[model samples]
Target: MKSSTAQYVMGIDFGSTTSKTVILDRAGNMVASAIAHKGSVSNDGAMVSMAEALQQAGITEADIARAVSTGYGRRMLDIADKSYTEITCHARGAVHLVPDARLVIDIGGQDSKVIAVDANGLVSQFAMNDRCAAGTGKFLEALARAVQVPLEEMGPMAMTAVEHLSISNMCATFAETEVVALLAEGKRKHDVLGAVHAAIASRTLGLIARVGKREPVVMTGGVAKNVAAVHHLEQVLGMKLRIPPDPQIAGALGAALFALDEITSPDHADEEDRVDTEMAAARCGTPTCTAKKPLPANVHPLHGPALH
Candidate 1:
């Protein structure tokens, strides 16, 4: 605890569809961050993303005093000092990006989540759709392919849509078929794209219903880059959304923030020694306490964000 204030910390979010890394100084300012959309995840991919982030920050691994990992493949990073759920990390990152944010909607590659953050800028209730790929980024990618449009071009194409084509299904596979059918029926590509956005927005509304709504909603994940998704979701929810400039890296940012908290805590030195001792004594050939501690009993298991 003797002035770890100048230390730099790292956060690695090894998600299902992408790997993102963020570095921050103890003051919680982002030093550098990088997101790599690599569908197949490995330690090497995480390392590459972290290396890129370090390169951007003009720093190296030696500079990072602590690190945390989050997202679907969080445990793959053996170097992480800690690991937290994406629910907690996403909430932390969203609140950091938009402090007034009450509801956070994240449409990640394989799933979508709706998180409710309370007045204190911490998570309250949360809901997610992990079983199905519908209403997620992958769903959009499938539809884009069906329409013969590059995935990156679909959003802008949707913007030019003058008419909406109601898609019959929200299921990802069925929706792809619908997109193809719409095209065969001589429908406009832009209009089909617009309908896809609305279909996703409508499905997101169902998630929002379960979590309930709060004003000043913000969105994160790669899907936030889609103007039509944001626009259609806003139209459906009737509230303007707050989107961070780097929405996709919010989870990594939150993990970096957690690292900052961990490295500078009053018990930092003691905890470090405790973890080392636990590993040595057990001789399990593992970092016994690193990234393995559960949330304290006083905090809600699913909603705690560990803010500074």
Candidate 2:
């Protein structure tokens, strides 16, 4: 890959609620990564993340040899040389982070997906819940509001539950109503939050079943940082999960790897053609279907200082 004169490559994930960027050196090592929360599929968010990543890597945009993009707004980035679906990028990125991972469970802001990967980091099968926000971060955000708790505090409060409570097993909108009803019944906020997290675990398990469960499962995306969600998932799966230090950037990292491949791999053109067709088929062909839904007020997917 270093045979090319290019010194670095870049990958951007234009997610609905957040944008992520990753920069890699010629040696295929990640040099910098950044995440920005700016409304749904906002171009400003993408630019912010890319600028932060480049600044952290101490490189100019001119220094990057190639760039690839993935996620909801993948095609919206004019700077991207190529684009891939989240399924492909997430599978590739997860395997790169956890080489022994045979299963990947990615619960992002808008969707939840389970991918079955082979030893070579190739996706064997995958399943996603994109129809609604039933098992996603947005769902938790809605429940948090209904329970009158901060989004960031829901996880810890849920861990303190002493009773098992149940929320409506419907869409996020309906679930919020159920949460309100539970609170009206004098249920503790902690127990109600517990039910909310457990519900996500149950929905995620259904996705896992579709792709067939495998060992050494890896969890990625914003939800992996949620302690209660992870705990509930582990209890339900009867196994522990491997979480990367920075789980949100897995898709962007995968995009960076593909950018590297574009410079290094001999059959890159043919691979690009194949992925283009797949991306088209995966699209819902409707603006509203792909548009970013409004996130809860005062909610930010990223926590603390940006990772360099």
Candidate 3:
């Protein structure tokens, strides 16, 4: 709560399954970051994660001057000074990680998107496969379970495949059935995993073509961590992909960059946010405000009512 601590900012990306958070100092350097599963990705989850990150940074919530949020749960976050789409945040995050990247492909928990970045690092055009989970991380997660491969070990297992089997279906339920049949036929787990990765890669590349792509491509999102998926995507695209240190946090980092911009830009100097406090109080008037008490410590402004 010291005056010097006011130079920090926060950004949160609350995706369907995972929520990412990034905190930056006045110089726009990352001070702390975190990712958490969505089972608690709402207010409590974000607060818990933020609290943890603050603890690591040896700071507190009062140190954050502004907070920007993005992703599916942004609206529910309530503490955000502003909200932006994942596309913008991802584009910014990519450019920060890879300054020369012209094309960015992000395959997240719920969907996949390919974005073209302009010279100024803005998103120029984009394509998304959001109608279903056909070409996304969710598909890979389900396939991993069906193939009896642990989520983190899938990439390595696929690489061990002796035969490059092909998966013709991308629909989750249908693909699950196909995998079940393959297992019944005594197919090798390695081959099944390879097929799944290849199918996802092919589908994702096709999506990129729909929006058009450029060179110096970079991949973001949780899916990018799958070495097999990245390898397959490289083959299908016939190019190399620049990957950040931790792909899952790209959205969060981008949002933090935006917060830095908003804070440092003189034009927005007076635009300090009071939204989090206003929102916490507004939601307190509801009947479902169980416990109906103020939050603990600095949490009182971020979460007003102890709703059930």
Worst 10 residues of 2 by lDDT: 299-308
Local accuracy of candidate 1 as per-residue lDDT tens digits, 166-247: 9854599988888888889999999999999999999999999999988889899999999999999999999899999999
CA shift of 61, model 2, Å: 0.8
Model 2 C-alpha lDDT per residue in residues 1-308, reported as the tens digit of each score: 12246699998999989999999987899999999999889999999999999999998888888888999999888677667899899888999999999999999888999999998879999999968899898898778778879988999999999998877655899888888888899989999999999999998998999989898999999999999999999999999999999999999999999888877773865465565545544653555233233445754321001100
Tens digit of per-residue lDDT, candidate 3, span 63-170: 887677887787676566567789999999999999999999999988798999999888999998857788787898888888777899999989888886777645
Give the higher-lDDT candidate: 1 or 2.
2
* Cα deviation of 280, candidate 2, in Å: 12
lDDT by candidate, in order shown: 0.83, 0.86, 0.80
Superposed Cα deviation of residue 262, candidate 1 (Å): 0.8
Per-residue lDDT for 7 in model 1?
69
Tell me which residue pairs clash in candidate 1. Answer: none
